[model samples]
Each structure stands twice: as C-alpha cells, then as structure tokens.
Target: MSAVLDIGSHKVVCLIGQQDSNMGVRIIGSGFGVSAGLKGGVVVDMDAAEVGIRTAVEKAERQAGMAIQSVSVNVSTRSLRSQQMEVHTEFASGEVADRDLTRVIESSLSELAQPEDAILHAIPLNFSVDGEDGIRDPRGMFGSKLGVDMHFVLAGIGPLRNLAHCVERCHLRIKSAHVSPYAAGLSVLTDDEKDLGVTVIDLGGGITTSAIFRDNRMVHVDAIPLGGQSITNDVARGLSTPMEAAERIKTIYGSALHGADDDYVNIPCPPMGAQDTLHHHPKSLLTSIVRSRTEEIFELLRDRMTDAGLDVYAGRRIVLTGGGAHLTGVREIAEQVFNKRVRIGRPNGVLGLPETIDGPDFAVATGILKAQFMDIDEAISGPPDLSGRRYRQRRYSGGPVGRSLQWLRDNF
Candidate 1:
C-alpha cells in the first residue's frame, strides 16, 4: 500500500492504501491532525504547517505500524494558475520505438517555459501523431514527427516555496503534488458528466476551486480565494460571536437560499459572558451578510465559466463537494446560477475506509489513491505483459492530478 497525505487548510489527512488487480483501492489505515500554520489551503506560516504535517504523518505511521518517507499532497489555493500548451517535435530516426517516442514527447514538453510560476503540475493532455489529435499513447504508431498538447498548472512562487519547504521539513519525499481542487475532482466525478460535460466546484474552507471538464479532458481550472471561511468570519462579526461559535453556527444552520423568515432569525448571539443575548433575525442577518457573500462567490464562478467558453450540454451538470457543500440549499443555489443539474457527490467505493472518513470531505484523498492505481495500469498496458512485477519496472514519473475526470473526483 502507498502512503498518501492530504495537507488541507482545515486538517492534515494521511492514509495507507493500495489497489488490487481489479483496480479497486483498499485503505488500511488513516490519520488526521489539526492544521496549525495554514490558511485557506495554503501554507502561510512554514513552521506551523510543518508541525501539522509531522503530527499527522507520525500518527498515520503509528496506526499502520510502518514508516513512510514519500507522500502525495494536494494544493488548493486561489493562487494556483494553469495553462494549455501545445508542443511539436520532429523524429531524427525513422524507426518507431518507445524510448524514442518518450524522448520526443518529453523534449517537446521541456521547451515549455516555467516562468516565475512554480510547477503545480505538468500533465500530458493528449498526443497528436503527425497532426492527428486525441491519441492517448502512440508507442508503436508510425510517425516521422510528433506534436503534443500538455496542460500545466502553476502556483504563485512565494506560496509554492513555502509549501515545498514545509513538506521537506517534514521529511516526506514529494512524489508529486496535485492542485487541491483538481484532487477533489478525482474522487467524485461521474462518468457521464465527464463524457458529456460538467463543472466541479470544491467549496473548501478557504477557497472555492472550480474546474471545467468536457470530452473527457480538463479544459479549465481556477479558483476564488474566498470560500466558506469568509462566511464564518462574516457571521462572527455580524453576530458578535467568537470565531469558533461562528463556525459552529455556519456548519449547523447555514443556508444559501435566503427566505423571508431569514430576516426574522434570532440567532443566539453570545458575546464574552453577557447575560442579555443580542437578538438578530435570521433574514436580516443573512441578506446583508451570508446571501451577499454566497452570491458574490457564485457570480465569480459564473464569470469564470463564461470566460472559459466550455462545450456544455443542455442539462450540463455541476458537482458540489467539500465542507461548504453541506450548507443548506447550496445545490439549488448552484443550479439557478449555472442552469444545470446540480448534485452533491461523495466518494463511495473504497473497501476498508472508516465510516468517519467516508464522505465528500474524503474526495481528494480517495482520488489520490485511485489516480495512482490508474497510472500503474496505464504504464503496464503495452505489449510483453507479465503478471508478476519481475518482468516490468515500475515507472516513477507518474502522477494523477489532471484530465477532465478530475471534475467529478473533486466536489461533493
């Protein structure tokens, strides 16, 4: 089993998992730690984030009775950036061999300039052999030259360095890193949504990450820095409650669809040891605060969708996942805005995962395990197949963060 860790703004989750021949993953153990030095899914204080990671990893190791040195992590701050690049290469030799083709593809990718942007990810989108598009792999195909399209996600340099440094300090080998929103997509997206078209909105505590998927490819990825955490902050200020109490109220009674009664809601506004409670009606509180912020977030998402010009069907769908998705009436709010069938998706297919960890919250971690299994199968799909590990070497240069399939894997 491979040990995977998800360093989230809310918590650090670790899991020991692996897949069988059936392409199904079985999680043997899991651990979590309170996040110390992170905000909105980005590491703001390096030392604190390292402490959180160490605590979580050590707990997972103890639970599994084994040591783990390497792990896959998720990145999901609004600071992340992505772009689609197409590179072309010419074959010096006429023969079609695997190494020759990989070199050409890798070299074509090497020309891709990584500016001030640190690499969030470098994923092979699709290959075009001699101008043919949509070729997943072209090992034996005859082509004098090859052209390829790759999707790369980059993060703001300063925030990214903080993350890398924090993980390094924890003594975890970064096998690969995945954008958090994209990682969420891997666990919850349905096949039909990917085949036709859909959007995934991971309503994280600090950021609302969005990705568009069509033709089984991730056409776009982006995020808004504001998320559920903002709402809680607003509640805390408006209701004059502690941040902890605001979070409690938001989780227990938050709703997106404001009603006339919302203005009449008398939230038990508790202050620092005061006998008289501040009586604020729910509607008055929501309209000026909660609804406004949620609408703003939805409008921002709408703007992003419009900018992408995605190929969507009439019943185009949206998958809502993450802690914010639990807010009442969230699906309805998203449906009206996107004009699509919206539903909450949960990660449902693991074998040994505990019930406590079985929910939309686990989507990114579940996707991480599933994605690794997919890469392994794809790597060994070529000819000269052997049942045992003796015949083939496990390729290390693989990661599971992209492709449109991520749209479903992410959100609830």
Candidate 2:
C-alpha cells in the first residue's frame, strides 16, 4: 500500500491506497492529525508543517504496514487563476493520429501564458477540427487539422514553494501538488455536472475555494480567503464569548439565512462572573452575526463567479463541497442569491472511507490520492516554457470581441 499526505489549515490527512482491478484503486488505510504552521491553506512555517505532514503520513503508514517515499500535496491559495486555451495545427500528413493529436495539444498548451504563475493542472476539455465540433475522443477521428480546447489551473510560486518545502523537509518526495479546487472537483464532481456545467465551491475552515467547470474540465477557478473561521470569529465578537465557546455556538446555532423563530435551539452562555449562572437562546444571540457573515461570504462567491464570467449558468448548477457545505441552509442561501439549482457534493471514486471524511473537507486530499493512483504526477511538473504559438481566442458575434459568447455557449 502507498499513501499521500494533505496538509491543510484545519487538519493534516493521509490517504492510503493500492492498485486493484475490479474496484480500481482501493483505500486500505488513512490517518488524520492536528495541523500547525498552515494558514489559509498555505504552509506558513516549514518545520511545524513538516511535523504535521509526517505525523499524518506515519499514521497511515503504520496502519497500512507499508513504507512511503513520495506523496502528492494540495495547494489552496487565493491567487490562483484559470483560463482555457485552444491550439490548432494543420496535420503534417493531412491526417490526425494519436501522436499528432498529442503534439498539437501540447503545442496549444505551450502557448499559454504562465510566466509568474505555476500551473497546477491542464486538462483537454474538447476537440474541434475544421468545422466539426462536440468530439470527445479524437484519436481515430479523421480530420485535416487538429484543434484542442483545454483548461489550465494555475497557482502562485511562493505558496507552491512553501508547500513543497514542507513536504520535502519531512523526508518525503513531493510527487505533486495540485490546486485544491481542482482536486476537490475531481473528487466530488460527476460526469454529468462536468459535461453540462457546474461550479464547485469548497468551504474549508480557513478558506473558501471555488472551481467553475464546463465541458467536463475546470475552465475557471477562484479562492476566497475567508471561511468558517470567520463565522466563528463573528460569533465570538457578537456574543462576547471565548473563541472556543463561540465556535461551539456557531456550529450548534449558526445559519446562513435568517429564520423566523428564535426558539429553534437553546444554548448555554458563560457567566459574566465566575459562577455558571447565565444562559441564552442560541438562536437569539446569533441574530445577525452568523447570518450576516455567511451571507457576505456567499456574496463574495457570487462576485467571484461574476468576475470569472461564470454567473451565466443557463444550463449549469452549483455544487457545494467542504466542511462548510454541511453548514445549515447554505444551499438554500446560494440558490436564492445565484438563482440557480444548487446541491451539496461528496467525494467520488473512492472506497473504504468513513462517511465523515467522505465530505468536502476531504475533497482535495481524496483528489490527490486519486491522482496518484492514476499517475497524474507528470501533469504537475508541467512545461515551464510555453511560448510562441497561436491559440484560439474567443470572439462574440453580436457583442464585443472580449465578451466570448461562443466560448460561454461551448462551455456552459
């Protein structure tokens, strides 16, 4: 058995796996440990983060009874960006074979601009040749020229470097580090959602990450640097309670949408004095604090969606994942604001995991493990010198050229 470690701000997780024929990759073991030296999904300190990574890895290793060498980590930074690129090549033999297709696809990828940006993943979404469109597999398709549309997920260098250093310092080779949103999307997003359109929102403890998918690949993604912790803070400040108490209160009583009755739940309050005499209605105290902050986060998410031109989801849906996905009334709030169908998503393509980690908090870790089993590490060490090539740029028929209605239609 082999395993990979995911060092996150809230927790450090290890996913242990091995190859299987009938079931694909099977999960034999896993581990979780407290996290230190990580903030907003990036490694804030090397030594402490190394300790957390090693702790999780060793637990999984002990359980699976296998020595580990390398692992694939995840990066969930706010500075990440995504864009789709299309490259075309007239066939040398006026024929498109497997190798020729790969070449042209690589050529298009070579044209993408990632000078200061580190690519987390690049996946081909679709292929169009000549005037033909909607081709999923083009290996055997006959075409005079090959055109490929792909989605590239990129992250910042400092965040990636810090994460890599932490893993390496733990004596484990970093086989790869994928964008957390992409990883989460890979784990929770289904084929139909990806094919039609969907926005995957991962609400972690310290950060809220989002990925917009069209044509079954991630075309746009963004991360909000605030999360459930903010709610906890809001509760603490509003109620004038300790952070721990406020966190407990928020988890027990917080709701994104304001409700009608304040009698939904009763909560204990720390006494103003040393005596344990004071108590309050949990719902009453949460009056505007919890609801306001949560709504603000969703507003930020909507703004991000609008900024990325993903707000037009005529045929798309919103799929929420992560620890915050379980928050009360999130789907309801998102649907009301975005005015679209919304639902929560759980991890897919994994076996033998408890129903708890099966949720959104484990999305990225599960994706990294799945990528490792699929041997997608090569995709992480992407080509650095992508220069001097022609790519398909979006053009709007009636609107401005930068509007890209065709691109929007082709994707959404």
Candidate 3:
C-alpha cells in the first residue's frame, strides 16, 4: 500500500492505493482541498499548509479505511531545474566491471556545486563503452574507456526542508520527493512519445513547468514562476472584479482563441463589495485579457526552451498537463507559439478515481502512485538524508556493485 500527496498552488490532493497485478496501482481512496498558505508552489505559511495537508490525508484515510504513515510528494518550488553531467574513466587491462560503473556515476555528482541544493532525480540517460554509445547495461563489456551521461533534477535545500517539515507536521512521513514536471510526464506520456522525444508543459496555478524527454528519460526541465494564477490576477485587475468572480469568469467564459461572436456573449461580473450591484462585460473582453496573458506565457516558454539548448532535442512535440491546461483553446495557442504539435495530457493506466478528480489536475499525484509500483526512483524515495544533515546518500543503480550493495542491505 502507498499514499501520494500532491501539493500544488491551488489544491492539495491525497491518494491512497495498493499495488495490484502487472505493475499497476489501483486507487482506493482520494481526497483534495483548496490550497492555502502557498504562493507560486512554495509554502508561505507552514501552519496553514499543514492544516490543508492533514485534512486531505485524513479524508483519504477515512475513505480507504486505513491509516497512512508516509507518502510520496512532488517538488516544483524554487526554480526546479535539470542539468547534465558526463563522466569518463579508463579501465586497465580488463573488461568493464560493476565498480567501474559505480565510479563513473559517483564522479558525476561532482557537477553539483554544494549541499544547499539536492538532486531530486539522478537518471542514467545512457552509457558508452569503448567509444560506442547507447549501451543500456555496460557490465561484462570489454572497453578501455567507459563514459556515462547523467541527468539530474535539482531543488533548493531550504524549500525542500520547509516542504518536508510541513508534511511531518501532519504526522506523516515523506517516502520520497519527485520533480513535479517529471512526475506529470510519467503519468501522461506515451511510450512512443518518449522514444521519439517530447516536451511536457505543466500549466499549473503558480508555476508553468516544461520538461524535455527523449529515449524514455527526462533530459531537461525548467519552470516559469508565472502560471494560471497570474492570468486570474490579470483578469481580476482588468475587470475590477473580486478574485472569486474573476476565477469564475475565467473558467466559464475564457478562451485563448476568440470566436466570431464572442462580443455577443455578456458575462455577469459580481460586484466587488456587498453594497455594489452586478456588472456585465462582453465575453470577448474577458477572453482578450486571458489570451494576451496566455500568449506572454507561451512566448516566455518558447524563450526558455531555446535558452536551455533543448529546442532541437524536444522535436516539435508537446504534451500539456495540469490545471491550466483546461483552458479552452490553449492547445491552439501553444501550438502557434511553439510551432509544435500540442495535445492535452491525462493520467493513463490508473484505476478507481472519481470522475471529478481524474483529470489532468491530478496527474502529479497519479504519477507518484505509478512511480511507487514501477520502481522508478523518480517515483520512489531515494536516500532519506536530505534535511540539511551531514549524512550523504550514494547512487549505485547504474552498475552491478551498487545493486549488490543494496541487495545485501535488504537481505541482511
């Protein structure tokens, strides 16, 4: 059994489930609550965030008829980013051994500057032996020089500690932490899309995240602090409406592409104060505001993708996920700006979710559950020593030595 807690800027989702046959997870219980004490995916009020977390978890527990002691959470706050590190070593007079693989993977950690930021995911993209690339497993292969290309997802230590503390306050343990965009990609991306290369753009409330994947591994990840919330704020300020009414209008009448008769549709805008009366505005005006802001976001995304050196690797394909993806006509706008084929990403291969929460909004939580069953470290917890402690976590999965060491620890 496992639990997944997806803490976002707009909502907190908790899911309880168990691993079933064929490496699939069946969701038994799910709960979600309006997010509080968060701004742009970072917790601003620890107490408020803790309360929300406890409420969601308790709801799921009640539904599952079981208590959850720990959970896997998603991390997207504080500039979540990915970097590439390459390591090469020469073998002396023999075939490559498990120790050689371990050494090369360990050497890649040197790319990290310090302990203030931790690697959320260390994915071994590929291995090369004797200058021949694309070796899935390098063990027992004779090669004088072995090389590795490692992709790492990193997050700031302070934000990570704060997130961990919030979860602990609910009397729950964090089984593991995963990068948000990576988790979303895990749930929604198809095998063909991953193999051919694709980018996932998570249209979240407080942050818009982009992740590039190729050969079934995440190669790049970047985030822009602005997201759906920014658009809502723009609506509120532009129409002189309250936050609630602005959000309502954005959902009910907003569109990224204007229609021929949008001006004929007038949406009722509730008065700002109790004494004020109702006001109405042309729906076209509302959509125009949304379109302008969304365009800016898409343009910024284009710039970021190119700046990351991932423009070519992404291969002109994109998958949109998260709450903001629900906006009508967003796919068209994104396609125009990115010049790529764009489609909405929904969580697949999961069972037993209420129709209400089974959309792209919950992709991260669903992905976390999927991660647990698949043994994807991006889904499972890594070393548990990320709390600004002196203890360090080691990586061994890239080679046989690490696997043997882990097996001994488990069996001993």
TM-score of 1: 0.83
Judge candidate 1 at residue 250 and give its lDDT: 76
lDDT of each: 0.70, 0.73, 0.84
Ranked by lDDT, the better of candidates 1 and 2 is 2
Best by lDDT: 3
Give lDDT for model 2. Answer: 0.73
Q: Could you give candidate 3's per-residue lDDT for residues 293-389 as a string of tens digits?
A: 9999889989988887779889868999999999999999999999999999999988886898778888899988888888552311453346533
* Model 2 regions more than 4 Å off: 91-93, 131-134, 140-145, 263-266, 269-282, 374-412
Better-scoring candidate (lDDT), 2 or 3: 3
lDDT of 2 by residue, 52-109 (tens): 7778888888878887888777778877777778778666434456676666665655
RMSD of 3: 4.7
Off by over 4 Å in 1: 21-23, 92-100, 272-279, 311-315, 376-412
- Model 2 quality (TM-score): 0.83
Residue-by-residue lDDT tens digits, candidate 1, 148-212 = 67776667666666776788898777666666666677788877777687877888888888777
Clashes in model 2: which pairs? Answer: 322-360
Candidate 1 local accuracy as lDDT?
0.70
